[model samples]
Target: MALPAASVQLYSLAKEFTADPQGSLDRLAAIGLKNVEAFDFVRRPAEIRSALDASGLVSPTGHAPLLTDELWTPDGSIPTPAPEVVFEAAAAIGIQTVIDPFVAPERWLTEEGVADIAERLNSAAEKAATFGLNVGYHNHAQEFVASFGDHTAYERFVSLTDERVQLELDLFWALTGGQDVPALVSRLGDRLTAVHVKDGIVPASNPWAPGAEAFGSDSLDQRHAGTGEVPLAAALRAGSAIQYAVIEYDRAPGDVFADIEASLGFLREGGFVA
Candidate 1:
């Protein structure tokens, strides 16, 4: 397969992007990036699309909540919009896939819960197609905390979902969940279309585990890609059909732009992305 394209999650520079969408996108373009993965874009699709156009960037994939009533984040929860609304916004922003970025830990703890999650996503996938788009899920550590018959909740959910429901694995979080990251990537194979290429010193324990203390993104020691614990190069190499190697940082170690540039440099020097 051809090497995946390099993209950055706009959430990596959330504050800056929120403050000046056009200027921030321009800076990313100057850094030689041609694509971005949008975050929280449902409310401002036209503005983001305009900014992307001005900067000669395109957002082929973006994050939005799809399978839940409320979207969970490290910081807090945000109300979810209807699936149709999400697809309309994504289409407006020229996004080809709308990825649900997170689900609560509790929901992944039981076989029934995992099935429900898959069912909802499969239903969302059907709805998404009407708008000429696709739907996917992005994982954190929560999905790994539970298992059924030797398969992780993450894996089980994968098996249960429709073939059209894509997957985006977050490397650092997979490591945090004590997974063999590259092996998981290899197993995911073609269904894995995108990856959040984040690197960081993983937390001592699964923060999303039951009874774990609450933590926020600011508390994480996220670093530039290939500079921390995640086996990014191996993971990227293991993917059979990954189309986007997306750089992201839950918390940048320094200036966000410079941090993003450093990660992008890793992708280029390693020939991991086109």
Candidate 2:
């Protein structure tokens, strides 16, 4: 099956990116990648954009917080700016989609909380249009912690959001949350604009469930694409409209760039990308 353009989420090499943005991007470009996913860039769009221009890399999708007071990552938290400010920066950096990468686990367990997320994203999506941008959400295992009726909080949130508010499901996290990864991807249909093309063994325990609030990521042994538990090929085949097959790692199993190259090779060998 024909696949989306292959890209790497910059967060996969956060240390290298922070220490030497230009060198880091050049290194990825050397790996034969022309696209990358931006993370935590709402604060320094111009700086990042300059590097992208120099390196000839395009950031079509990025991570930012539009609904929450702050965004959290394994590294730390970033206070959010107004949605309009975010859109301006995203537009400046030439990002087509600004995807909120995480929301706390506590927020996904209730009806009111899920609606609030959908409402905020829908409002943001409307504002994003003026900037020639799209808004989306990226999932972690927490999104599946609670089920309303027969569906997960993740599914409920998807149903509530406007179609313009899209999704980027993290496959490894979905498996970590005890989901049938490929089936879930298909269920999302065309709303999935991109997916965190993660491949890792699901931990023996689903630690991000509602009560397990102090979830940790150390247990996740993320491997190269197609080498772990996630059914990446099946899932990729299901996303008919996916625009980017983004490689990522919450924690690198080894040298980060080498791991990225390995995933890119998997994409090529699987014919998941050109």
Candidate 3:
């Protein structure tokens, strides 16, 4: 299947956006990006829309807490009011899919816990639906490793979540968890709605945990999509169900814009986009 034009994952350009969101977005658009996904956007809705209209960029995906404690005052508790506010903000900004990237502690692990998460996700999806939005979950390596009962967290999530709730498959982390990207997508079927296109070259010493100072920095040596070891073509084949393919590299060599340019060039040559 032919892929859509690549979308920029704004987390890769978080620094730039923080400094000057409108200008940064315009520059990204000038560089041939017409779509984007963001964890948090600095611009207001009107500002974002104006910039996008000028740049011809569309933002379809958003990231926020699913049921995290941070939104609430206390630690490890979900606040009733915050979800509504978050939902409204995303909907206002023209975000079609709002993703909860992590499972809160109370909703993590155990069969019952998995079921609870499914129920919560379903509720969020229902709420989002009223505003013409879809709710989804994005996975990291942890989801594949975090097991509950007979199934891994990813398995449980796919099994228990309602059909309406979708998934944003982070391919690099899926690989890090020792799962085949296409195989997992095939198994999940239509529930897989989006993807994070990232790659890495981990040291052989500890492929999953490369250094002692901070595992976060080394677990995956974030790099441009096609520059690392990920089998890009095979993964895209598996991602037949996806609509938006988001490029994200948590860390880049040299300047960030250059890194993004390199990634886009690689994808264009590979025929993922025109």
Q: 35, model 3: CA deviation in Å?
A: 0.3
Which prediction has more favorable TM-score, 1 or 2?
Answer: 1
Best by TM-score: 1
**Where does candidate 3 clash, by residue pair?**
none
Residue pairs with backbone atoms closer than 3 Å in model 2 (clashes): none
Highest lDDT against the true fold, candidate? 1
Q: Mind giving the per-residue lDDT tens digits that candidate 3 earns over 159-215?
A: 877898988888877777667777787787777878777777733332222232324
lDDT of 1: 0.94
**Ranking by lDDT, best first?**
1, 2, 3
Q: Which model, 2 or 3, shows the larger lDDT?
A: 2
lDDT of each: 0.94, 0.89, 0.71
Give candidate 2's whole-model lDDT.
0.89
Per-residue error for 256 in candidate 3, Å, reads 1.3
TM-scores of the candidates in the order shown: 0.99, 0.96, 0.85
Ranked by lDDT, the better of candidates 1 and 2 is 1
Q: Per-residue error at 22 for model 2, in Å? A: 0.6
Q: What is the lDDT of residue 240 in candidate 3?
A: 59
